[model samples]
Target: MASFLGDHELVKTLLSSGALPNIQNYEGNSPVFASANFSNNKILKLLLDNGGDPNLLLTQEYVYNSPLMIAAINENIEGVRLLLEAGADCNYRNQLGNSARKIGEASLNLELKALLMACDNPT
Candidate 1:
């Protein structure tokens, strides 16, 4: 909830209060996933800083893939950057055969596509 709302302070307090940043809901979506889907980089950073997994995958049937895929699909440059820095697999393919680079290429943003390609070999 807080993560989806981009409430950085609330998320921080929750984390400080022992909130599990990586706890996925019934839909296999975690706080990091919510933050990335919502394009809230601050909340994403808060979650990642508190042990969120950037490469966490959605278990069920969700249109989105990993955080990197969501960020890339949404053309969220900073989110993609942060996720990549946190070791997000740019080549990660979901059950639907979706990958960050694939969606990025499908999008109209050439710059984002270029970034995805640049980080093809993510560390």
Candidate 2:
């Protein structure tokens, strides 16, 4: 609900009130993962900036995707950049042995692929 709203201030207030940023919904998805899945760049940024764990793995039925993988799979370039900047593991692979770069390639999202490659290099 709140995750899809793009209410950054409300989210901040909630976090200040001690709301757990990593709380999973009924379907076992956290707000950060939901923001990534929905391609909500602002929400994703807010979550990440407010201490959402970039490395938090999804334990739901979707079982193998990280937030970076999901953002790359969905072709959300900004989301990918944000996650990468927040120190997400660029080489992190899911059960399918796919890293963000591979996911971006499979999705044909050149921008994200390039970003992941750049992060991987970082020299």
Candidate 3:
């Protein structure tokens, strides 16, 4: 759970020592999910740089949310931008049949909503 605590340096060191970024907790939440949920931009960036897959779906608890969805729901504009720039699927649908765009809209976060719209029409 150190990674979940937003210790960017420690998390990076652990990852460098071969700590699997894909490892999940008891509830099956990945590091990426934790970082997104907590709005930890530093941890998120470190994880992304270290091969954390933003597109990885939560298969256990909270299956209705994705890393992108979580970021959007949390109004994490930078996190959402990072994930999108990292090639996360902007149109991914979760168990609730909602995409990141929908989550952003539902969040009522102007910045996140704008980011999602930009993602939806990149160019």
Candidate 1 vs candidate 2, TM-score winner = 1
How well does candidate 1 match the true structure in TM-score terms? 0.90
TM-scores, all candidates, are 0.90, 0.85, 0.89
What are the lDDT figures for the candidates, one per model?
0.85, 0.78, 0.83
Considering only N, C-alpha and C atoms within 3 Å, which residue pairs clash in candidate 2? none
Off by over 4 Å in 2: 121-123
lDDT of 3 by residue, 1-123 (tens): 867888888898898899988787777788998999899998998899889998887777565567988888778889999899888887888777888977766666788878887775332
What is the Å distance of residue 4 in model 3 from its true position?
A: 1.1
Per-residue lDDT of 1-123 in model 1, one digit per residue for the tens?
A: 889788899999999999999998898888888888888999998789889999988665765589898888778888998898888888888878878878877878888888888875643
Higher-TM-score candidate of 2 and 3 = 3
Model 2 lDDT tens row, 1-123: 688676777777888898888887777778888888888888788788878988787877656578888888778888888888888887777777777766766665567667877766332
Best model number under lDDT: 1
How does model 3 score by TM-score?
0.89
Every candidate's CA RMSD: 2.0, 2.6, 2.4
Provide the clashing-pair count of each candidate structure: 0, 0, 0
